[model samples]
Target: MERHATSAELKARAKGQLLGKYGTIIPAILIVEIIMFAITSVITLPLDTQTMPGLIISFIIECLLQLFAGIFIAGQTYLYLNISCGGNIRVSDVFYGFTHHPDKAILIQLYQLLLMLASFVPLFLLLALWMVIDSLYMLIPITIAFCFGLVASVIISLMYSQSYFVMLDFPDFSAVQCLRFSRKIMKGSKARRFYLDVSFIPLYLLGFLTCCIGLLFVIPYMNTTYSNFYLELMSKRNGGNVQ
Candidate 1:
């Protein structure tokens, strides 16, 4: 009978791991943010979203950027997982995904994105039908469908939350296999994961109050906590062995 750590316990562990390392972690996370921001700014600086074609092009560019950003995300996962496991910290670790299997990293992100978009298809169809009908009577069904779609999207997101982490841990696993393994491990833990996520709301709110500067600290804390959560899950799944 393996015992799951409470969110408090996990956060405490993350705090312990981060105790003297904030100097390294904070700058590492900041460098990643700066690079991402610079990339987005440079790429979108030329786009004019005033026209229909421009809007469509802008949307496509945004989606492509997001897919590309998935590689950086995998790199972030690699960095944090390293921190959680007492490995050396490097700001350059942020490019781990790019140097590793970037194609598979992008594929994993693309699959998750497609699945999330699919979850919203029903709602989109209902909204289109409502627009065509323009009847107050159609509102009820549309609202119900919207709620269902929202729930499905949330669940799907949670189900695949660990996909990036899985990819980093099992370099040989296919993107689909990583997604499947993530869904498998998340079987009964979605609600727990949800609760852990919700618990961070206050810190985020407090961070926002500091003119957004506080997030420089909060973000790493949250990432490390999540890293700890992933390791905890893996440990339990592996009969008390983390790796």
Candidate 2:
């Protein structure tokens, strides 16, 4: 039987991996993620969307950029994981993902993004319905439904969170196959993964408090921990002893 590692174990292992190379590791991760942060900041800034055409054009551009970012980052995450597992580390390692099976990469990320967006559709629908109906009584139910949708989305998203790692590690797998493999491997461990993520929230909050300077360390640690977790799971699956 394959053994599953807890979040604590994975984080410790990853931290040990980075002990002698913080200077190199941290900056490499930042190089990959910086573009993502910049694009997101631009997307969120107050846009003059008073006109329909302006809104549509802006939305289209943002969507395309986001899609491009997602694909490249999926590759970068693979890069980081490989490095964490003792592959050659370089600042340019972030760009190495561009040569991966990119078409499948885009497909998987696009589907996941679309599915997440679909999850919010109910919230919007309920909000619109509440505005049209002038009843305090109906407002209560709409709000309840919206809350349920949000929770469901969280669960759904977490369940397949390992798909990116799978897609890269198993290049022969299609996007849907990668997703299915993630779902299978993650069985009964979604909450554990969620717990792993939640444990880092405080560190992230503290990092933000440091004028975002601390994120230079925090983000790489977080990303490495996640990648290590995937690696341990993969090792166990292969019946090899996890290091």
* TM-score leader: 1
Candidate 2: tens digits of C-alpha lDDT, residues 1-243: 546777788888878877766777667767656777787668756566788777877777777776776567775686567757787676766665577777777777777778767877877787777788867887777777778878877887787888888887788999899889998878877887889889999999999999988987787788888888787777776776543
Q: What is the C-alpha local distance difference test score of each model?
A: 0.89, 0.77
Provide the TM-score for each candidate, comma-separated: 0.93, 0.85
Against the hidden true structure, what lDDT does model 1 obtain?
0.89
lDDT value, candidate 2, whole model: 0.77
In candidate 2 the C-alpha lDDT for residue 95 amounts to 67
Model 1 lDDT tens row, 132-234: 9999998888888888878888898889999999998998999999999999999888998999999999999999999989998898889999999899889
| Model 1 alpha-carbon drift over 4 Å, by segment | 48-50
Which window of 10 residues has the lowest lDDT sum in candidate 2?
234-243
Worst 10 residues of 1 by lDDT: 19-28
